[model samples]
Target: MTAGETVRGLLELTRPINVIAASVLTFIGAFVAGGVTTEPFAVAAAVAATGVAVGAGNAINDYFDREIDRINQPERAIPRGAVSPRGALGFSLVLFAGAVVLALTLPVAAIAIAAINLIALVAYTEFFKGLPGLGNALVAYLVGSTFLFGAAAVGNMGPAVMLFVLAAIATLTREIIKDVEDITGDREEGLNTLPIAIGERRALQLAAGLLVVAVIASPVPYVLEYFGSVYLVVVVPADAIMLYAAIESFEDPTAGQSHLKYGMFLASLAFIVGRLAVTVPNAL
Candidate 1:
C-alpha cells in the first residue's frame, strides 16, 4: 500500500467516529457531575483517555475479527488488505499505551476504572464475543463506564451513576439488535450470539423490552433534580425515537440499529442541554 493508503487504513482501524462519540460521552459525564469548570484538567484527561481507549479497543477488535470480516464485512481494512493484522495489533497497542498514560494522570478511582476497561477491551473479542449475551453485556458496561470514569476523575460520581445505568441499558439493547443483524456471519463463524442462541425474533423482542425500560426511566435525571426541566422536553422526543427504532428492528435490524444510534445521540444532547440550562443560569 502507498503511504497515504496505509495512513487511511490505520485511521479506519481506529474507527474514528466511535472514538469521538465515546470521548463526547466521557465529557458529558464530567459535565453532569458539575466538574467541567472546576476540574477542567481532570475532565480533559478523562475524555482523552476514553477516546484513546475506544480507538485501541476498536483496532484490537478489528484485528481479532479479521477472519470473520472476510465473510461478514469484506470491506473492512484488514479483510480488504489495506492493513495487515500485525499492523493493526501494533497500532492498537500504541493507542492502549496512550490511554494508560492519560489515565494515570487521573484520580485513583478513574485509574482503576481505566485498568478494568483496558483489560476488558483486550479480552472482549477473544474471550467474550462468542458467548450468548455476555459479549453484549461487556460492551454495554464498557460504554457506560465512560460516564463513571469521568465522574470519578472529578471526585463526584453520584450524578454519573444514573447516566451510567441509562447509557448501559440503551447500549445493551442496541448490542442485542446488532447481534441479530450479524447473526448470519456469527453463525457461520461458530460464534453463538444472542440471536443465534435464541431465535432472532425472540432476541429482537427482548431488545425492544429492554429499550422500553430505558425509555420509561429516561426522565429520572430530571426527577432527581440532577437536570433541568428542559431535560424532559428533549428526552421525551429522544425516548420516542428510541422506541420507534426498537420496533423497527423487528422488520429491519440494520435500519433499527442505525436509528437507535441516532436516538442515543439525541439523548446525549439532552444531557448537555439540561446541565447547561441549570449550571449556566446559576453561574450568572
Candidate 2:
C-alpha cells in the first residue's frame, strides 16, 4: 500500500469519534483549570498526542485480538485484509512512541499522565483484555486520563481532577453496558467480559447503579461553585437520558436495540455542553 492508503487505513481503524471525544474532554478539563493561559501550541500538542495514543490503542487492540475479531468483527481492517496484523502492531508501536515524544514538551505533570496512559493501554492490550471487568477498568482509567492530561498541561489539578474522577466512573459504567451489548459475540469468541461472567441481569443492575452515580456525581463540582449553574441546565437533560437508558437496560437486558447507543451519543453531548458552559462568557 502507498503511504496515503496506509494513512487512510489507519484513520479508519482508529475511529475519529473516539479521537474527537478525547479532544473535547481534554478541552473541558483545560478550560475548568482557570489559571491557564491560552497556549494554542500546547493544546494542539496535547490533542495530537491523545489522538496518537488512541490510534495506537486501537491498532494494538486489533493486532492482539485479530483472531477473535476475525470471528466477531470480520469487517474490521485487520480481519478484512486491508491491514495485516503485523503492520498494525508496528503502526501502534510507532504512534505510542510519538505520543511520548509529543508529551515530553509539555509540563512534567502532563508527561507523567501521558506516560501512565501509555502504560495502561499496553497493559490492557496485553493482559487485561480477556480478564472480566479489569479491561473495562483500565479503559476507564485511560479515558479519564485525557482530561487529567489537560489539567496537568495547564497546571491546575483541582477542579479538573474532580471532573476526571467522575468521568472515569461514568466511562467504566458505560464500558460494562457495552460489554452487555456485545455479550453474545464476546461469548462466541470465548472472551470473558463482565456480562458473560457475572450474568446479564446482575450486570445490567450494576451498570444502572453506576450510571446513577455518574449522573449524580457530574453536577457536584457545579453545585460546589467550581463552575456555573449554566452547565447544570445544559447537561441535566443529557444526564437524565443516560440514567433513563441505564434504567431501560436494566429493565430489559435482553433487548438489544439501538437505543442504548443513541443514549451514549446523547450522553456525550453533556460533555460538550459542560465545556461550553465553562468556556462561554457570562455562563455563570
Candidate 3:
C-alpha cells in the first residue's frame, strides 16, 4: 500500500471519533491535574501518543477479530477489503511502538502509566476481551486510566484519580450496553457477551441500573465542594440527557443503530461534563 493508503487504512481502523475521545480524556486528565500551561498545546503530545495506542489497539482488534467483524461488522475495513489482515497488523505494531516511544519522552509517571496502558491493551486483545464480565471491567479500567494518565503527565494525581473512578463507572455501564447491542452477532459467533450469558432482560436491567448510578454520581464532585457551580450547571443537564439516552437504549437493543446512538450520546455527555468539572475548580 502507498503511504496515503496506509494512513487512511490506519485511520479507518482506529475510527477517528474514538481517537479524538481518547485524546480528549487525556487532555481532561491533564487539565484536572493543573498542568494546562497553554490552552492549545496543553499536553498535546501526550494526547497524540495516547491516540496512537488507542488506534493500535483498535487495529489489533480488527486483526484478531476479523472473522467476527465479517459477521457482525461486514462494512468494517478488514471485511470490506479496505485493509488486509497483514496490513492492519503491521499498522498496529508500528502504532504500538510509536506509543511506547512517545511515552518514554514524557515524565516518569506518564511513562509508567502508558506502559501499563500498552500492556492492558495487548492483554485485552489477546485474552481478556473474551472473558465475560472481566473483559468489560478490564476495558473500563483502561478507559479510566486515560484520565489518570493525563494527570500523571503533569505530575498531579489526586483529582485525576477521582475523575478516573467516575469515568470507569460510566464506561462499564456503556460497555454493558454495547454488549446488549451486539448480542445477536455475538450469539451467532458463539462468543459469550454479557447479554448472551446473563440473558437480555437481565443485562439491560443491569446496564440501566449502572447508568442511573453513574448519572446520579455525575455531580457529586461539585456537591462535595471539590468544584464550583459551573460544573453543577453544566454537568447536571448533561447527565440527565445521558440518563434518557441510556433508558432508550435499554428499551431497544435490537440494532447497532440504537446502541451506537446511545453510546455516543452517553460518551459525549460524560466527556463534556468531565471536562467542565476539571475547569470549574480552576475557574473558582
Most lDDT-accurate candidate:
1
TM-score between model 1 and native: 0.98
Q: Which sections of candidate 1 miss by over 4 Å?
A: 282-284
Query: Residue-wise lDDT of candidate 2 within 52-131, one digit each (tens)?
Result: 88888888888887877776678888877778878888888998999888899889999999888888877785789768
**Residue 93 in model 3: lDDT:** 96
Index of the highest-TM-score prediction: 1
* Model 1 backbone overlap count: 0
Write down the RMSD of all candidates, one decimal each. Answer: 1.2, 2.8, 3.2
Using TM-score, rank the candidates from best to worst: 1, 2, 3
For residues 1-284, what per-residue lDDT tens digits would candidate 3 score against the true structure?
46676567768998787788888788878876778774335387689888999999898988988887888789888887778899899989999999888788778988898988898887885687666777889888888899888888888878777678777877786777778877777777777878788887787778778767777676666656555566666666656655666667657654422454444345434544555555664543
TM-score of each: 0.98, 0.88, 0.87
List candidate 2 stretches off by more than 4 Å.
Answer: 1-7, 250-284
The order of the candidates by lDDT, greatest first, is 1, 3, 2
For each candidate, the alpha-carbon lDDT, in order, equals 0.93, 0.75, 0.75
Worst 10 residues of 2 by lDDT: 253-262
78-101: candidate 1 lDDT, tens digit per residue:
998899999999999999999999
